[model samples]
Target chain A: MKPTNILFTCAGRRNYLINYFKEALNNEGLIIATDMSANAPALADADIAITVPSIYDENYISTIKDICLQHKVTAVISLNDLELPLLAKHKSNFNNIGVKVLISNEDVIDIAFDKWKFYQFLMKEKLTTPKTFIHIDEAIAETENNTLSYPLILKPRWGSSSIGIETVDTKEELILVHKLLLIKLKKTILYKASEKEINTAILIQEKIKGSEYGLDILNDFNGNYYGTFAREKLAMRSGETDKAISVITPEILAIGEKISLLLRHSGNLDCDIFIAENKIYILEFNPRFGGGYPFSHEAGINTAAIYIAWLKNEKIKASFNNYKSNITFAKCDRLLKIKSNS
Target chain B: MKPTNILFTCAGRRNYLINYFKEALNNEGLIIATDMSANAPALADADIAITVPSIYDENYISTIKDICLQHKVTAVISLNDLELPLLAKHKSNFNNIGVKVLISNEDVIDIAFDKWKFYQFLMKEKLTTPKTFIHIDEAIAETENNTLSYPLILKPRWGSSSIGIETVDTKEELILVHKLLLIKLKKTILYKASEKEINTAILIQEKIKGSEYGLDILNDFNGNYYGTFAREKLAMRSGETDKAISVITPEILAIGEKISLLLRHSGNLDCDIFIAENKIYILEFNPRFGGGYPFSHEAGINTAAIYIAWLKNEKIKASFNNYKSNITFAKCDRLLKIKSNS
Candidate 1:
């Protein structure tokens, strides 16, 4: 077996994932973690913790490349959503150094990161999605034309998790929240959104009331479709799945297969969908292990183990993807301590 | 079928549960909600939104009693964990008024609400639990003796959610957080805990590291033993289950059976257990529909509907408690907009 040396970029609070991978490596390899903060709890749990510059820093990629070379990293995985595009754009550079960056292609990552483009991608595939407007005036016009309803969802065009999301039931609340988002984004140190792609700070979409589902769609390195595992969201907090149960609904699986074939992502593709009025609607896409992946992992899907097996050119058991249904789980806060050497 | 008028006391954000009961009644019954805030989103979804005094107010129970009598409420349910004891104490008063308050016995509620008592109960039952200490000196000594490890969990003797929870790896951090919790508790509006019961602001418990599971143990009014449905926690936010997958492990289920027999809680009993080193450790218990109930509900355990049926003296199907395994679920934020009748 090729010795596995995995590197996690922007490892914030995902100490659990790092530990899981560490266990998967079975002490055969080391797990290296990098974050901008030396105090990031997850970094302390890694075999090697390196504090690096932030994602937007010009030295970010070079710093990671150097880490990869220094540590002989065989795989590079990023925990932050914003880092995916950059990693995908520089996949070849890492590949030249014999490092495999676990990310989708540039087009896929671009569509996944940009909300407007994601909505268009879904619409182009003739899939149902909430009607989204990139401009405030167009959103207002659509609302006036009775094409949209009250209790609209306004969010940053380029956002992760549920930050900057506001639900406005009236045009007044919409106008106020829209303006507030712009002001907030201008001052938001975390948001790296641009004003050019979006006419303002956020995109307005009709809030579809329905049961939500989180899916982990699998694809082989050759972009071949595997099955999809879905969990109906029972409770959510901070835009993460708080409580959910794995389900084997054929329709949802079919939708996953359709999207997988269309997007052609070569690994774990996290997707959000809503079932409103008995019709499935595609909501959002993140081409990485979402905060909800642990659900699939715990339900016997073993995506992490499967990824490792696939990378090692080992024959994977088909049963790995066939997770059992009705398995429910919840998460709680955990503490990770790192002793300071300085 | 007897017409049902359900009253949810201290209804915060459980619009989904209210709507579930509403659909179960099929518009033949009314849903009334009471809270300290008229702006409570769940209250707006109710047929009648009555603003009630705080739990400590002298007229609180009387106000709820009057609402029960006026609305001819068939059932009284509480969403807040703190309110469980209050409701259980006055269950007979509601009973005299021909209203059923869905709560366990006052003893069960007392043990569930008090962390120190819960630890004692678990110890007396010979069950695994994190070693807990009420005094800081004893906690420190335990660490010194190596009976308890570092990375202790410090929180108010009586707290809910993830609030006031501080995990400290060092003795200094533990002491600091303990003092801070006391100061914070003196300012918290929700906690009506008596100062006489707590010598310190916080109870120190050994932080047991492992996979956590949330179980909804169902029982009859007589507190008879029934099966439990459990979900392993995948992720957590703000102390609530964010993502979960359901599993029917026999050992975990047997632990639920044992606890159910010991506690003898009627109706819904929510418990948290951690599997550390193959030992199941009982963490906490809440004798009400916990935030994780949606996972069980969506997994086809219709505990709400079953509770309603059990109260109505109707025969319940045995299969309601036997939910299937491996179903995964997550929670998402939904807008519950209530138009002001004013």
Candidate 2:
């Protein structure tokens, strides 16, 4: 049998994923992990760890391609929100070298990474979403018209990290925070991405107070809908799912199917949704593995093994349908010894 | 030998401690963990888990004493800053039932839990510390007199969590943030603790920018200095150490020894310090097991095993003196399954 070597890019701290892939490989393949920093915890768990240039570096793509060629990588997976769009834009480069990059197309990635675009995409698809405004004047006009109220959320349009968020309870506080956030945006790593649309880089969102749910939409390598695993977030810490329970229902399944048909994102798409007053409101989506994936994996689904089977061109429809609901999990910290000079 | 069962109170997320004690016991004892919430991740790892009332409740101390008597608890260790003072206050109650609570005296806990008291204690001991002021007027005067500078830190004097922190770069920002922080203090869990000093609940201080280091100052069950393990923090995330490398130097060792001798804290005391221009400045200390304990444990110092030996009344000094320097470790997330009715 031919080996199905996998390359994980931007593998910052997803040590669980690296271990999962290694377990599924089962001596059949190698797991190579790369990140900008050599001291990333996940690197220590990989079979082969490499430190690569930053995703924004001019020769970053070539550096990745060189690693793929030298290691005979069969597939490439990215584990970062900021690096997904880069891989999507250069998907053909890896494909031309006989390596499949598991990323969505450029349009799908843009809709997922940019908050304004995501809101517009949800509206156009007739999906429920909170009212979002890109212009401060428009948001203020809505407030004055009594159509919108206070307790609004302000966040960067192109932000992936949970920082740079402000909740304003009054109009005066909203204006002050809006000004402060604009200045703060210029000092963040998101500044480079927001430079082109600097004027409309901040989004004024209506804060939704309801139960939050996360969905992991899975598609085959051919971009065909496979399954959607949903989990209700019970607790949150540091902007990640600290505790969650698997929840499956017809409403959530239908929405997942609809998004899968509309977006057709390859592999995994981590999504956020809010349920308030029996209505489901789509929040945002990411076109790659997210922090919430571990919850879904521990519940029942073994996407890592499924991906391995797909890479080996084996029939996986019957073997991979083992997802169950009502399982719960909580995240805890573990220490990983790292090589000082790695 | 009689069973040396240990009970960890407020065992929120310190799963490593639970596992370590279990391993060290190796069937000679049982590890019991208790928290207000049944869903605390650490509880799932213990041999026996219990849910108790809040530490502020009148029945809280009695509840803990009942558990000790029933389980034949040999030692009691706390993993929370807020609970250390409570445990110390009621240490005699547990001792009357033949349970040894691994906690410092009320005076030591008070100095560790309150930032203002910690500063005063440091000054009294002639230890190097940052200039701290409990009043905004005094801080402003210092800044005006050119004794202090901009980029100051404002935080709750009685805060255990790292949420309510603000860094101000100018006079206007400092004044505005101070007002906001005071208002915020009332809405946090620390409000109850800060009620007596509500008017002066906030602290303004010089923000030190330098290499941060964490030390695990160990004292035996008799409150005698045993050893000091120091690690240089390489990175921080969400106010916790993310990556660190062990560093044993004469300067750091001396500081640790001095604090241990002066405070005489029981078991483990997590201390934070900073070095700038070859000057060591003590930040603050917590008289309980902290998030940084795992780094020290994995680096070579088996404090968990040491605690077990101390509980068993076995010789531990010669066995635990194997700590080495230059070892590095990083914190990562691991998922633990939870029972729905837990």
Candidate 3:
């Protein structure tokens, strides 16, 4: 039998992803979703939905394994970035139980989960990125040397949801904002939430200007680059891309492929890229599906289908990037009716 | 030089088609549009808009020929079905002037332009079609023999815009509706308004039940079938499909290929198919882009690009019918901000 069972762990509000997978499955597979809350809208539409303990709970892994065994889930994935590290660290645990957890190896995930490490990794790949510095004195020296200047971004080293972030335009403002974030994030820095709290973990990088793009990079089960799609952000809402247009820039796709081949993340990898001054720059990486996936899918690139095919060991097209481009779309609020306490 | 100039003669309200052509050309070609009315929306967006005489005017052929010559147009095509027959009949007239008028041969145009002839051609092609009868006695005989019966559709032999048509349930209603259409159409039968008025043109066919489909079939410049795209009509308005979904039925595409190889119409040919009782049935055939071309194009099947490739002597994809299916779309009113009257 084919591996037709897909289980989404920590599937909080990703109903769109669930539906996309269901459509790709075309009723051939079962969608099993799990979250800490029974009221999560994303779980309402799944074939089987169960509430598991919180990610940090000591019994979380065993609870998920029990769910997988009960549902006969052959393929496993998660939408939560915090859950990825746990998934990766325990990938073998699931694999021993015949549940394939689609996540990258620990080394790749380490660089992805840290801003300074991601910067060094990109530099190693020979890809340009914004000049990033962890120490204020180093950044000030760069500014004095006229190599980089003010108008910099200060965010947590590996924070999710744009938490503890600040942008400054002048030297004094950069110093003040960096210090402010240093104290605020130290209160209880949730570095990916599921991991240990971090103190004095921050990233200050030069603010490059141009179009911002979100890429959905696909890889095989063995972390081999398959294809990549890029979308230029037209608007943003609450730190997430709201309106975007699919763009066909060879350099952007090339940069994504370079990163994928270097990092070797299995399955879908969410990546941030910058296009400025006629060149592409690499940015943050989230080793799972991000907010921009629906945009790619609507434009006719079915990453869900590609993922299922990879899981089934079926040969897919050489590149999922081959799609009709120039489509503009916006994210809209979708409500899923569910029982309040269910 | 390649055929870098495209001419749309008798263009009506198909502004979308014009824009699609402009995108495919990418500044490499010129789009020239013509219509009998200066207010034609499609012409308003073209690089060149010319008012041409009506098809029946004595100076019609000379006027189009002049437009082609003055604009240095290398390709000439029509959006009007009636113009297809005229263009096909006068193919050599355009060819002698060093212009390629993209239309099928006279035999194919004749069959496509006449419903009675289309029925006969389908029978010859061994394709399933709704049983049609022209004579009252023969229709009544079929009813008695239980071979066919009401509700029946009575319409003009080659009507465009569905001008003179009726659906009748009982035998009495069928006779009355048939008589009414016969008289009504005879008074001023604009069977495809761009052609000469026809008299005594009426058709009665069995109303097959099931979903209706709009097909866009592609052919090479030399009149060989490439492939076809199918869209199932979900909702229709004013004799046009307003909402539709891309459907992948291999038998339907195979039948289209079979018909195309037999008829060999160059470029885009819009044909209607009905899925009744789990069997595909051929309906009306329009030898030009119909209302459903946009739906097909949006689904990543680029007939405009395919057409340009064929014109430029480029080998297109092996088959146009190979596309991702199950995409649903709905058409809405779009406002074109044009001058009040220009």
Candidate 4:
């Protein structure tokens, strides 16, 4: 088989895409690596490496474009969100240079990147999701009118890893938090302003209260839902699950199928859901693989392989039924320490 | 009156926000300007001007951050989506430096950015929306199985201004379109690959077939639906209405209110709806100010002022009831060529 020339941009050290490519293609591939950090683990294994600034930098796109042209790169895949838009911006340029960028257009990426808009879309579709609020005034009014129960959660609409999240127990606290949030938003925008500018600030949201679950799914370009894995969170930090167990509950699986039907989502995704009061509410959707996605693969869901096959336009047999029952998985971060005796 | 320092970032020569701010604040604000293009139209009137690359570029943030620190800028208001995230990212940094960013957190931005995810979130809440898809596969399967009818349209899940859209007349066309789409996605992803990476690509969506309309809304951080303007599309390019007439049909207005209640969106938003065969299908949501928004504002809806007031934590009188009938408004973009002979 002829080898495919793939350029993995923003492929961090912990990316599962690397291993999946290696295993599926039998190491018959070339890689061009670009990253902000010189010590990024993926660089050592790449065919070529270039150290660049953060993807958010102004020169990042031009730099990538030049490098792709210089090395005759074939495909570019982003392992993170910040790089996704860059890839998108230069997709046509890459095309002109005979390279492929596996991302949607700039406008699409803009929509995919914002959480509040995503919620609005979901709510508009009548999908099952936890109750959420995007406006601080609306949330405060709800609080004052006792529209929501006490012990509610507050979160920023676009934050990740649990930043700016708080649990409030009273209307006074909600009001105080709103004031603080407005001040913070104002301050941040002002800090980025020029000598004579004003500050534009942040949006506040009412958080959902419940146990969270995740669904990992892969779909083909034709928008067919090929594979899905429902995993229950055994332990979580902020909004991420540190310890999760794969559960093949038919109920959850059916729900996953329903979501797949609804969004027709292609590529890899992690669907977050909340089970509160014995009802399921989808919290959010992540279009790409999450940090701890390997657990799902270990539980017999080869999402990466399916995605690869789909890209090649090959028919894949959905064989995920083998590990469909009460599969348990766990993830932990460990810092290696040398023994004193040594 | 205190001169509230405001920073306005614009792309190219556009300074629409300057006029909006001037009109809203009654010329009581100091407007600092930054644009990548040195000849930007707004630069001439700006109190202070700085040239920077696109807001998505890292240099833009760095430049803005430095400027904010030096000037003690009061507020940062972005006129585009590209700058919104950068303002949001350094929000905390601005707080530490004593400035303000009038935007939401990155998470909120993420959800707000992606239409497919937003639709799913809304669906979960049991809100009313047109049936939509995120994948082409599901759309094709449904069509083949005789689930969907003719006159269906295909759209990009995260698209704007109606790019890459097609209307289907039959199943054969749908299949042909689906195949073409598959090839397009693969080609796009493959072209960017090096020698060993796999390609992943875009999502496909179902088209809402019917009479389409747009609704502009302004909410506070508290989630209250404060102000709204209902407009009917008179002419459209792609899915975006290039020319529209402001209308206040009770049915449309009531639907907009229901959507506002459901989405709990704040600031400026444009919600698209389809009324076909006497049924309303909430098609998609644009969480930011749209291009044709000025028309609605000119038709007696001060959505811009309402947004500003909400940002300032001031009470706003809802003006949605003012326009109770169809008010005709016209818009067109024209190019002028100067003659050297003159």
Best-fitting candidate, scored by TM-score = 2
Model 1 Cα lDDT, one tens digit per residue, A210-273? 9999999998766788779899887776677766778888899899999998989978898999
Candidate 3 residue runs with Cα over 4 Å from true position: A1-3, A161-164, A192-200, A317-322, B1-342
Best by DockQ: 2
Model 2, residue A73: distance off in Å is 1.4
For the candidates in turn, chain A alone yields TM-scores of 0.94, 0.97, 0.93, 0.80
lDDT score for candidate 2 against the true structure: 0.87
Order of candidates by TM-score, top first?
2, 1, 3, 4
TM-score versus the correct structure, for each prediction: 0.54, 0.95, 0.49, 0.44
lDDT: worst 10-residue window of model 4 chain A: A333-342
Q: What's the CA RMSD for each of the models?
A: 16.4, 2.1, 22.0, 26.5
Calculate DockQ per candidate and list them: 0.03, 0.69, 0.01, 0.01
Clashes of 4: 114
> Candidate 2: which stretches are off by over 4 Å?
A136-146, A162-164, B137-145, B162-164
lDDT of 2 by residue, B219-250 (tens): 98778998899899988877779999998999
Candidate 4 lDDT by residue in tens digits, B77-193: 666654555576787887777666765566655555556676677688776665566555676687778786565665434323212555556565555554444443443332222
The TM-score that candidate 4 achieves is 0.44
Q: What share of the true interface contacts does each candidate keep?
A: 0.03, 0.80, 0.00, 0.00
- Residue B155 in model 4: lDDT: 47
- Find the candidate with the highest lDDT and give its number: 2
| Clash pairs detected, candidate 2 | none
The window of 10 residues in a row where model 3 chain B has the poorest summed lDDT is B333-342
Which stretches of candidate 4 lie above 4 Å from their native place?
Answer: A13-17, A41-49, A69-73, A104-108, A159-162, A182-207, A317-323, A334-342, B1-342
